[model samples]
Target: MDNIFKSAMRGALFFAAACLLLWGIVPEWKSVCAGLLLGAFASFMNALLLRRRVEIVGQAMANRGMRKMGLGLGSRIAMVLCVAMVAYKYPETFNLPATLAASMVMPFILLVSAFLHHKRH
Candidate 1:
């Protein structure tokens, strides 16, 4: 699982870097690229947060330390909401549709990473 997450994160980071490069080279599509960059960044942070929470849950379960612990969905939602708000606030600088679409990309990244990892191993 950790290896899969790391692979997905590397893919996401590469994507974000590409977006940044596009933003620099293409002035006309700056808004769209900026949106993609922000969304990808947010998605990365959310994944990291989720990974940490899952690790914590696993540790707790192993130790029988807690009865119930949420996976921090509320915080993740808040982070996404914040990204949406930022895109909304800067309509000229960020495309909302692109931002929203990009934000949902991490799960797919994770899926593909896992698939490739499984195939390789």
Candidate 2:
């Protein structure tokens, strides 16, 4: 429960920071809000899903003696395909620049989550 709260707070902070940055650059409150909300949601979802998938792959690697490099390559390819599909399906909602920004924000989300998790431990 504590860990979950910490993670949520971390995600919120990341979202706010990203929003502020976007607002500063774009100077449009509505667009900035939309972009920030969508970007933060995407980043959070990506982190959660990717973490689960990576854990499964890690377990498989441990059991089968698989190479980490192959896992890394596969994950990268999967991410690209997933992003492409999203972009294709929702072009209006996700343009190239917004998608790029959202992608860039994901690592910050993950880093915040990790930091909170580590602090709890």
Candidate 3:
């Protein structure tokens, strides 16, 4: 979890700088930046939510016989849905492809972190 957080933060900083550079150089890319930033944010939020959900479920399982998964996964999905919808609606500003691609940043971060950790060990 700590590693996840660290990687997410590092990826976010890298994305932020890339977004800022895009925002400055290309006017059209502003939309790309918007979508990319939003997607990156969703990735970060996902990591945190997943960690929290795991903790909650673990606690519930220890306390009770059969506990339901009470994570607000619906709301989380809705959040990403809302963003995707907005980006889709305004294709000129927020391109769908870029947004979708950017959403995978966290996975990339995780992979890189894992690889580095493995190599170090």
Candidate 4:
């Protein structure tokens, strides 16, 4: 399996475990799980995006594929905007602070997950 994917899986597991610990066990953070889940999903999508980008750069596609590349990038941006809009419009369900916090920690999760996965092997 690709190292990046392994890392992403680890990150998702870690996030889920942490969320369960906090929301299931700790009453204070019970309401934040929804946002946390959204954030985790976003992070997973981001990882896939990164992997695709790596593949694109790795292949060194010619001008013909550049349009597809641009479209992909545009779609990613749209996803980001949608996430923001959803969280903003539905704060009760999404929890702004928690969602933002999750968004911020996504990259960190990716890195830590990758590192731990690498270390285990």
TM-scores, one per candidate: 0.93, 0.49, 0.78, 0.71
Report lDDT per candidate.
Answer: 0.90, 0.60, 0.76, 0.69
Better of 3 and 4 by TM-score: 3
After superposition, the stretches of candidate 4 with alpha carbons farther than 4 Å from their true spots are 61-68, 114-121
Which scores better on lDDT, 2 or 4? 4
Model 3 lDDT per residue over 1-121, tens place: 5775686578677877898789889997888898887777777777667667877788888998676656377866766777788789998788777777776677678777777766777
Task: For residue 58, give model 1's deviation from the true position in Å.
Answer: 0.6
Per-residue lDDT tens digits of candidate 4, residues 1-121?
Answer: 3875776677677877888777777766665787777666666676677678777766666534553344666666566666667788887777666766665566786677677777898
- Give candidate 1's error at residue 59 in angstroms: 0.7
What lDDT tens digits, residue by residue, belong to model 2 across residues 38-113? 5555555555656666776778788996644445446644665566566657765555455556655767655666
Going through the candidates in the order shown, the clash numbers are: 0, 0, 0, 0
Model 1: clashing residue pairs?
A: none
From the highest TM-score down, the ranking of the candidates is: 1, 3, 4, 2
TM for candidate 1 is 0.93
Estimate, for each residue in 34-85, the C-alpha lDDT of model 1 and write its tens digit.
9998888888888988888888888889998974667499989888899999
Q: Candidate 1 at residue 54, lDDT?
A: 85
Weakest lDDT window of 10 consecutive positions for candidate 4: 62-71
TM-score of 3: 0.78
